[model samples]
Target: MPMAADDIETLIRTAIPDAQITITDLAGDGDHYAAHVVAESFRGLPRVRQHQAVYAALGGRMGGVLHALQLTTAVPKE
Candidate 1:
């Protein structure tokens, strides 16, 4: 079964408590998603590391319950 968008957001929120997350279903199917996350903790991190953190927040579901995720991360605007 495909994962719900709310589940994805909840997982990220659990890990990165201060994250500002926006999830969009690129396709009508729930398996493909795009996530844009903003967080204060990502301020000094590299882009790769920031993305990794968001992926990690989803636990090990990347290839199983969740099919594909296009992720973008950034620190909050000043």
Candidate 2:
């Protein structure tokens, strides 16, 4: 089954309530997506750690049902 964009957004929002997220369907399939996320929670985190947090929000579905996720995480601009 393919993952929904809204669902992905919701998951991230649930994990980081103040996040601003943009989810794009990379392959025109729900399994492949690119997410650009800005959140207060990512504020001092390393790039890898920030990415990890986003992936963890998906409940380990990265290589399973979710497939590919090109993720970019940033702290909210001052």
Candidate 3:
């Protein structure tokens, strides 16, 4: 089954409690999504590492239930 947007947000928030997350259903199928995440914790991390953090939050559901995720990460503007 495809994952729910709320579930995705919850999982990410669980991993990064301070994250500001915006999830959009890209294809309207519930499988493809775009996530824009901003967090103070992302500061100084490389882009790949930031993406890894969000993927880790998903707990191995990336290629299975979650499918494609178009992710963008940014450190909060100070």
**Worst ten in a row by lDDT for model 2:** 53-62
User: lDDT per residue, candidate 3, 1-78, as tens digits?
Assistant: 999999999999999999999999999999999999999999999999999999999999999999999999999988
Residue-by-residue lDDT tens digits, candidate 2, 1-78: 999999999998898888899999999978999999998888888999989888889998889889999899999879
Pick the winner on lDDT between candidates 1 and 3. Answer: 3
- Please tell me which predicted candidate would have the highest lDDT against the true structure: 3
The lDDT, on a scale of 0 to 1, for candidate 3 is 0.97
TM-score pick, better of 1 and 3:
3
RMSD (Cα, Å) for all candidates, in order, is 0.6, 0.8, 0.5
With a 3 Å backbone cut-off (N, CA, C), the pairs that clash in candidate 2 are: none
Worst 10 residues of 3 by lDDT: 69-78
Please list the residue runs of candidate 3 whose C-alpha ends up more than 4 Å from where it truly belongs after superposition: none
Cα deviation at 66, candidate 3, in Å, is: 0.7
Q: lDDT per residue, candidate 1, 1-78, as tens digits?
A: 999999999999999999999999999699999999999999999999999999899999998999999998999999
Highest TM-score, which number? Answer: 3
